[model samples]
Target: MTSSPAAEDGVVRADVWLWAARMYKTRSIARQAIDGGKVDLNGHAVKPARSVRAGDVFELTRGNERIEVRVLAVSERRGPAPDAALLYVETERSIARRQAEVALRRQHAGAPRPPGRPDKQDRRLLQRLKKSIRD
Candidate 1:
């Protein structure tokens, strides 16, 4: 069997591909993520030295966002966002899952804060309460 041109020559280091694809801010960070097991290749955890080729799939977890992308092209150099986007195609299921996670986070926003710090009178009352408790 034969592979397409991109697949044939699409081999690239996983960290480089990740950085070139703009998945991480820099190659070093990408490497760190791979070492930390935050990046998975083809359903298994991979090392930074792993090779990423066209048609390969990667699952990346960044904090609360879990992304799954299929490699479409490979580049050794980092480029503009549009160019980087050409390197991978995010799966629809991944997009939907990420969105759902975002929505879930939004639904459980942190506890509401008080309007402001206690006023002078409020502070005085609190102080008195404290003194009484200490007595």
Candidate 2:
């Protein structure tokens, strides 16, 4: 392996922190996730250049699950999953709630929807939009 950390403790970049934390598979994915507005820095959207410090909280959305983690350490080269885990602290509440939501969503995927014809409201909206766009 060949690498040197650009940061000492808290001077790490946001993408680097995200990758080291194992939030995303690759640093490029972390950057793309950041660019796609799937990741937040201290409750706001941030680019890859954003700085991270110890104790800073992050809100990351990878689908319907929202994960909240606090920065504990920072590293550029992702160490083993065990070592990478030291870089962040996850909250129990967030984990439990996310798990429950995931389970519920999975359970409901095959559930049948009420059998009915399309609603009139949908037709009206579709036609109205079509007419408006013709102008």
User: How does each model score on lDDT?
Assistant: 0.89, 0.85
Candidate 2 regions with alpha-carbon error over 4 angstroms = 1-6, 109-135
Off by over 4 Å in 1: 1-8, 114-135
lDDT of 2 by residue, 1-135 (tens): 544455754478899889988899999999999999988888888989898888888989886679988888777777788898888888787789888998998999999885776599877988899999997
**Which residue pairs collide in model 2, if any?**
none
- Of candidate 1, the 10-residue stretch with the lowest lDDT total is 1-10
Q: Quick one: best lDDT, which candidate?
A: 1
In model 1, which residue pairs have backbone atoms overlapping below 3 Å?
Answer: none
Clashes of each: 0, 0
